[model samples]
Target: MSTRREARVTAARAIRSHAEDVVRAALVALPPRERTRRGLAFHAYQRQVRTIMRADPVAFEVVETRMLAEGHRTSVIEVTLRGEVGVDAGDMLHVLWRNDLDRIAAADAVTAARFWTTPIPHRPSRWARVGASGLLESVVDLSASTDSDPARAERITPRFFTVAGVEASDVRLQVTHTAGMPPRAASFLARVRPGDVVEARVLPHPHRVAHDGPGLAVVTGSGAAGVFAALRAGASGIRLVWGLGDKQLAPWVQEELREHLRAGRLSSLRLALRPERVTDLLVDEPIEQMAWIYVSGHESMGAAVDAALRARLGESVLREMSDGLRCIVST
Candidate 1:
């Protein structure tokens, strides 16, 4: 996200709480001493990837930390880090030992040689981006009370994890390839069975700040991963609803974005917010990120609220739904 506003904490918490988790490769063993060099180096490499994510976490669909530095000439690891962000030679060896580093390509080579000459790290964790908006670029170590839930996401921890994209789909459509999709639209489509067609729309939010030609989009997916991915994919402005699922996180998001925009601290601003619902409609206005908004549930309910938002935000920008991510051409 741009320096335009601060990231909201409550919104973040809501999404984190409600997000569905799917784990991948839960077993990662620590590397031996000889591999320590590569381990540490790979750790630093992961740090570089983290920085790229910090810059814009969801820039690419998949950014393998191991493939970094090796010059994986042909792959989706679009972001690169060197100079300040990349690691040192000694640090590289440390990565070899961390078990975070693994060489997936090498057939037969000495562990030491792999440590020294290993261009890419060995079998590292999978960094796949799903849909959702309002993901922080960096991985923050937030102090979490264990009483809080940390669902099926054994892959990335809830405390250290940040929001990405809110978009979802079982059919594997590339929302990042285009612009963004609303959370409801994405969720509804994500429920589609294999090869099934569902209509989705990458509509521009009415109150949302627009770009010159194409207008902007407010992304909705499961977590901050989608947010990072959407931002990385070049969506103009985003509705950071995933992480900031409610108004508590709203101030945090606002503050963070404002700090980024003003290039100053907003601690002195003394802004306060209270989430209130008016007649079954949640109401918290005067907030900049979202305007005149009431999150509606499913189809019929969605239509009623959608009509209101459409009137307020504009029906023109609110393009009709699309066939959610069924082989749409990507740039």
Candidate 2:
């Protein structure tokens, strides 16, 4: 007889396999009209397929499997869904399944390589344009503000975790791409093209300056949303801390930021490995002066940096934001 663990693994795999088949069948049977009405659900299942072709089986690697009380069992699977053209890099699918009474309760695709449990609603994208080194920018326009002048351009809300731009009455966004993206974010990236005039929503918020004093901006994967916010707010001194893996999009981004450094808009820029501690970037009197801080990056590293910043600078001075590995650290 097989061990209890063995039986659970086998059962979990079977459940996952059947679920994949059902999703595929549902997608194939979905007509154009039905897709329009239930596009959200159908599109979601379409993305769950790991292979490039719809006919291929979903490739799920069992990362971990565990048994629970009441005959319940859990399985964590790593899924990789490749795009026809391609994604930036490090894109894969992650999901958890609970098996009980021969039925499985499936969860939403976590989508991010890093652990980002929080889910945010995504508005339809107005426009999408691709830039250097696999950088995809999603644009959303708030159009004109009713509370303020219609002719005057409205500025984007400066939220630490999200990257956005507002110029000429347009709001631009650059989501930090990784190996695997959330279902909604991936679908947005896949369908968006330049000058398409798509529909999308704009997340609004109150804008605030980096801080009362000089600030240090630490970023990992984002295209420097915080830095732009700081400059727009007329920050005098700014620093950039960055890191990346094999797919280094930073070098291309650094060129754009260089002009700011040369123009004296930035005080300093440091590139370090993800494993390095945030405190290593501190130098001279800045540590003691209580500089305002922003840290953004992968959930794992970002959390570590946040902890370190809080320890070194305290919670009052440090700010952080991210959607999984998609993050932009800034002041």
Candidate 3:
């Protein structure tokens, strides 16, 4: 077997739901209006297999016209997942097999079905709507790192936990979701059946602590200011502004972020990479049904961050910002 497969097998065993952790964390930072009890009841679905980058890459994408489309609030990465070693037994290289889904679901998804969903992506989200299942996909992607070092997995777990903390904060059960969702909603999200240790204690976002969050919008230029404008007006919700992938963000800033991440102080992080494609490298398929999350990202480094956020999160829930990202103001 190649080293990539070796890495995949190694990563699949440990970090099975890396993307889910990110999605769930992103929800935590949404606007307070949307964080209500019922709002969160349905919104928690974002936490499951949704964020995992798909094995097969696609070219089609949705557009995000919201004002808060800054890259800071969202997570952008150049993840190089190894061959589908961890996915299934088939010798052929494609990894997104159904057997792998059944197995991981058995371990994580089945237990935590609340978080996991069929492969179909949700349509763009509306401000007032958080719908349920769209389709049933046998194929499942386990969010894991290709790194072989145990310490790397260990180090990354903290990132997952920190983001999970962001998910847990201020989330209330909205009557809309409660009335519309099935009876088992709370039971599932409170502690999904899957026995995954998805949560950790990371530092709080500076805005979460200082401003009594939802955190502050650290807007940079006109784009950022636009995002700040929408957010201040209550049209937008949780989001961030990202830095350049190569040189935009200084090295010192990256080091400080690492330290803060360890301390759980840095609520979010960003990297402005000039991606060849629109969707994030972490996710293989085009974004969908994740409209509940509101974020903004860079255009040059990658596809429009707001576009991805808007595609996942429908326009209704999105608030346009002066900056280039969309804001998640409500559930």
Candidate 4:
């Protein structure tokens, strides 16, 4: 191995050792009940680190530590890896710290804490419906408002994750928001390595329209991932409509959409600033001839779209519905 490769391997070993120590110390300080609850997750994280170290050989170093509200501190870690490893550092960090941040802080005698990793590219996986069986890569929080109820907002704000180990020609990312891309969405996009070819469309709220054909897909709400799945399955055209309710349109939103239009990925895009019903944004298009129709965002929207499609197409359309997004494809 070259000198740099040797250094990375050595650093990776050191990180593994330190992580083991930290986890051990944290476990010892926890009460038995808490320990039992956290031990499994902690060990699973450790194993993930070990897996990366053994196969990919990456080095991890803390770049910055920031103090947050309520005495919490977040540490930003930069990951360095050579070649393809099929590991998403950001998603790994999410699995490591999202739910366990508070527990880690309590055991370590620090404040509530979080962890984040800078963007790094690995490999792509098989594209399927958002909730379909695949290696879950990242869960992007798409909530637009602070007052939005988590339970209710989760239905509309889609979680975007990628499967691993598939050779794909391209990766398409669709982001819908009232103003511009959310911070979380930007972060998720940032993680795409500089070398990856990603076609990203940032659009305003969509008002539904009629479908074209098997080569076409219409996505309402936040089901961009459904379009991605369609693209992977060789769908040639995509229509994205954002349902922003009564939110005010920011000038930046249109500028960004114009930029995407210049770059060209969406077959058509629309923005609806004010709509009579938010659920109507789900599937306003006539779906008799559509090859794939995806409605994601709200449960009520999913039901309405499903009912409408069923009423029109009867049982001929194969349907897959999840809590967050719904997929309807012709057999």
Candidate 5:
């Protein structure tokens, strides 16, 4: 058989095996009275299993498998499948199990004949409202008040903004990270347009900031992490502004900068030790011209940038700041 066909067959088998294991364990866990002839639990589980077995086998692929933390002998498998088949299978498995629980907890005997299933609740799609007025206005807070950890903050944001038929080229993003905070909401960087801007200061660890297209990037820090992040993001034009104190770049960073400078991708390099200086540089351009602005890191620096932008653009600009390290986003 062909490799693709073999993979599909294997995936089908894995899904079937997983489904059977879960059903069998759940059935076994029920008390003797719950499994008696008059009970609907056994029949419901059997029907669900049969439905799973009759599903289009080639349509499903098991992507991840993990044991339940509840210490149940059964395992949960995350499946990637086409169309409504996956949804139907999930409803059967999850709702059938829940129905059995409801039957057990009820004062009156609840049978399968009376079991009512509810559709799974889905998150509302609000992507249409994004950039509706030819600009993007949103605040991604990674401070203690919202989500303290940048990694956790990334998880809360949608991985793709295409749900409402928005294309990558339709939006531009300007992101700035400061005060040693890990880059938050960097996933959106993957969709940033050519003219988008990215700026960072003191990235302690390597983070994926790579852009899908060439854009402008600015890095201000003594460490090389910020510069490396900008380079990885495929920035066609890069400007490095040195941070506070007399700091020297690592030998490798210096070498990389020189190479990019020779190639014309690294456009300008300078020094801006004070936060006020950085703020001045950030607001050098007209705020009304940009589509979106995301500022994060030190509260003082964020406030400074916010004040500068508001001062320049006045009420025409929309700005929001969160607690902890003030993060400002303007449109």
Candidate 6:
């Protein structure tokens, strides 16, 4: 049996090597006569796919693959991509497959679906002005006020969380450059000089800390800013599972978090490097023993945490707070 990495390489190579045929096959609507008439058209389309692949480099790790339906010659393959990228399997294939409705449908699109090729790591993202917070994390201001700035042209503003009366200035973000982050987004952030504008946005985090609650926050991954605010707003007993993948961002978000920890604002802080699971860090802890918990992180991690918490504390002690689970596809 091929490993996940091997399967990904195989998929990517197969797609790239036979791109022309795949595109042709994808154009299910094309009549047999049109294939003869469109000899040059396929070549042109092939060139476009080659160009996009060269820039993006299609690669993916297969989380799981199964046969959904079988045709005698070709089985209906279902795959889920590993890691995080904004682009889903369908969208990625769509770009290469062009506008073949039947082809797209057959692919069984998913944001993080498995792939046959080396999954392209780059995902598309919009530009936004960089706001300096003089801290470890960079801020991508997406408020209406910042969106209209000349620096931000034709960029999509991300939906962010806020209380009904809260203004833009009151919103603070801690943008972490995860492995799944787009190259453009990372480059703009990396080379950004003080006061320089860059392309970015705050991902939509629907969960907010409840107005009145006795629960403590269990924040992992990129949901730091919101939890920090909740702590400042007098939400007590924070358990921060800081998952720092690769290099640390400036002004050092940990410094502020550490300060809070020292001040007793945080109940605990566990740091995990890349390839380390946040769930592992939390597993042995007496979290279930705690009566109330408010959790936040990327969806996958959040779900794991929720399950852990539920098993430990049981349903009775668990009070509902804000759902800080991130919706976008990312690492």
- Find the candidate with the highest lDDT and give its number: 6
Candidate 3 least-lDDT 10 residues: 157-166
> Candidate 2's error at 181, in angstroms?
4.2
Compared with the true structure, model 4 gives a TM-score of: 0.36
lDDT of 5 by residue, 192-296 (tens): 333433221110111222222222222333122333434433444544443332333345545766886786655555545433366656545434543333332
By TM-score, the better pick of 1 and 5 is 5
Please report, as a residue range, the 10-residue window in candidate 6 with the lowest summed lDDT.
88-97
- For all predicted structures, in order, the TM-scores are 0.22, 0.42, 0.23, 0.36, 0.29, 0.39
Candidate 2 lDDT, 1-331, residue by residue in tens = 0001111112344345456556656555565333332244335434443233222213222222111101112111111122222221112212111111111112121121211111111211112223211110111112112111111212121122232323333333334333343223322333334443322212222222252345666655443444555554445577666553323333444565676678666777776544654446644326445345556555665566666656765555433222211122322
Which regions of candidate 1 fall more than 4 Å away from where they truly are?
A: 1-225, 232-247, 250-256, 259-305, 313-331
Tell me the deviation in Å of residue 36 in model 3. Answer: 16
Residue 91's lDDT in candidate 3: 10
In order, what lDDT does every prediction score? 0.23, 0.35, 0.27, 0.32, 0.30, 0.37
What CA RMSD would you report for each candidate?
22.0, 21.3, 21.8, 17.5, 23.7, 21.1
In angstroms, the error of model 6 at 101 is: 32
Clashes of 6: 29
Report residue 22 deviation for candidate 3 (angstroms): 48
**Model 1 per-residue lDDT tens digits across residues 220-300:** 211223223334334433332221122232333444445523532111122112232121231222222341222311234
Candidate 5's TM-score reads 0.29
Preferred candidate (lDDT higher): 2 or 6 = 6
lDDT of 3 by residue, 1-331 (tens): 0112112113343244445454546654565345444444334433322333222222111111112121343311111122212221101111221112232333322221222222212211111211211111221222342222222321111111111111112111101012223212121122222222112111111111121233423221122322322322233222244333322443543564465545444344443355423234324322332222333222332235545555654666544321212232210
lDDT of 2 at 76: 14
TM-score, candidate number 6:
0.39
